[model samples]
Target: MSDYIDQTHLQIYNSNVWAYGNSKWLGYPILKYPCDLFLYQEILHEVQPDIIIECGTFNGGSAMFLCSILELIGKGKVLSIDIDPQPNLPTHERLSYLKASSTSMQALKAAREMITLEDTVLVILDSDHRKHHVLTELNLYYPLVTKGSYLIVEDTNINGHPVSPDFGPGPMEAVEDFLQSNTNFIIDEEKHKFLITFNPKGYLKRIK
Candidate 1:
């Protein structure tokens, strides 16, 4: 297991899997680890959140992928936010797009308006990976995550956790900082069963 871990690190460093530049879901670019996506489906199945607030939309593949899973589950909606809109995003009845800074009040207001007090929400932070930005996002969105749901912070493997040594403090750092004073959420290691996730320690479940 130790040897495999070392080899995985080397592979990630050599191939830059953190970028996921060529990966896609249903033909649309989706820059995320397939392992993490599988874990997401598992969590979605277990938690069954009514709303998913995704902070980064990119090419919208991930949003579509989430909606696909939700469809199979027979419920749920995805609200994907991004600063710059892409050219072609897949349209789905369960998907909504917001073009705005994820940490901006406009984005927060939109998310709040879409979610009712009775809704169980799951939040994903995948935009502006810098520590400060992610931390701000964590503060702003964590409240939306209902008990037993997740507030996923993606790309935690970067910033030298195993790859992209020079990327600087990213999602992992943000999560660490957020956990210091917050007790409502806890890192759910079960999500790491796949062992090849980009989001190390990123699956934070609201436990309070």
Candidate 2:
């Protein structure tokens, strides 16, 4: 019965992911699972981070979503990074778009400049999903996450943790590699309490 439930969950997850490709927020494309988005809100509300460094802004829908939540929280700003310029991105006072590689020094400098010692920070890595690129991003951004905050690695479901089998050494592999040497963070399995998530074993919470 447990195996049957697991199989059913996977089937539903695959279908949801397929439909999620077309998902949008306020008419802007947002490539994220609905369950994860729900979890994001829970995290945002709990952390109340002063800064959210999002390493990927496709059409800016997710950034916009984050901004909306921050507005409700009445504090916080989003620094969304991406290599390509997205013309459709919406204009928001709380959203800053940086056109640079997520792991580039330029990007790092900008992020550092926006953060202060007193601020609580959260990082969301959704940019390059390749193993090396994701690993580099994990290393570069993990330090910015304040104690008790989160470093979310998205799309770990690819490379066959149940979806996109041919994606090849993606975020999941990068996360596993990152954890082997990093002890300050641990996978917060509670984040995925929802049965379906794009980020499997990807929610790393800073303990110290």
Candidate 3:
């Protein structure tokens, strides 16, 4: 359940009970969305940032995927945060975690010290789902991520549409707000099809 965890660890998570062609994670358990692995690899190659900041750590599977890539690269790591600690703790020489409210600047500052100022950093926003909550998270994380890096938001669409049962406010709303105001960020419409979700969200990579 530490840094060495690999693809073999993906077990038959409750959701995948009936699914076939079951891919596995070598060490960690729990299933994740399809884009998790894809985006992790894409970011590693395209952005190749020095520090990766993740807002959520549910089950630690996704973080393990990202951290594993960093380990393979030998120069990057993760500063992961969560309000509740997952029972399956994520470990790797490069992974550092914090158990605190992501909206707090104090917490982000503490995590900030772990990363270099000039090293490109990617911010994966997955902490809270509320519109205001996600918006607050973006405000805090946006400043830290390098200009060319990314601010990845997950679970934007809960049920295929804004009218979906679980749909309310989350990454989608927050990102929408940011885009309307910021001239530097651009939505990678070309990457739209790469997403697999309710309605799916596009990559809003920083261009300025």
Candidate 4:
């Protein structure tokens, strides 16, 4: 019975109506579930990371949202990266834009230089949901997550996690492979309290 209900919810979550409903945030198309946004606020407040590294910058709404939270906390910065530059992206003192592919060596090198060993960091991977791409990103940014901080792998609900059954090996597959050899991080199931998240079991918290 529980499984049946869960499947029904997944179907709704993958429907066009759901997608169209959450297409705006602060005057921009955030393309994110409100539940996920709420979870982010909670995570940010709890972790208070010195920096938030976001791999995919869509219309800049999500980055702007994160920047606002950092401002409220009176600290932290958002480093958002994307292969294509977003025209008219919102400008914020706490936000920095990197117009480069998230998986490129250039971006990784720059990130390494920007972050110090003592800085507390959080990472969000939302670009190139392909299994290989997500796995590469997980490996590259694993070191950036500070102890007790989260590494959020967004959109893991697809590829048969109940959404997009034919999407083919994606974030969920990448996460499964990533956890096999990486013991420093573990999925924090408590984040799933909302029961409707694009990222299922993708809230990894670095324990060491």
Question: What are the TM-scores, per candidate, against the unseen true structure?
Answer: 0.94, 0.93, 0.81, 0.93
Better of 1 and 3 by TM-score: 1
Q: TM-score: which is higher, 1 or 2? A: 1
Clashing pairs in 2: none
- Higher TM-score: candidate 1 or 4? 1
**CA RMSD for every model?**
1.7, 1.9, 7.7, 1.7
What are the lDDT figures for the candidates, one per model? Answer: 0.90, 0.90, 0.68, 0.89
Residue 49: error of model 3 in Å? 1.2
- Write model 1 residue lDDT over 13-98, tens digit each, in one string: 46754454567788888877777788989999999989999999988999999999999999999999999968888999999999
Give the distance in Å from residue 133's predicted Cα in candidate 1 to where it truly belongs.
0.2
- In model 4, the clashing pairs are none
Of candidates 4 and 1, the better by lDDT: 1
Top candidate when judged by TM-score against the true structure: 1
User: What RMSD value applies to candidate 2?
Assistant: 1.9
Better by lDDT, candidate 3 or 2? 2
Positional deviation of 3 in candidate 3, in angstroms?
40
Instruction: Write model 2 residue lDDT over 3-92, tens digit each, in one string.
Output: 664566468656754464467888888877778889999999999999999999878999999999999999999999999957978878
Q: Write the per-residue lDDT of candidate 3 for residues 7-113, one digit (tens) a residue.
A: 12223122454143244355665344565566657767778878888888766766788878777777788888888867867587888788888888767887689
Best-to-worst TM-score order:
1, 4, 2, 3
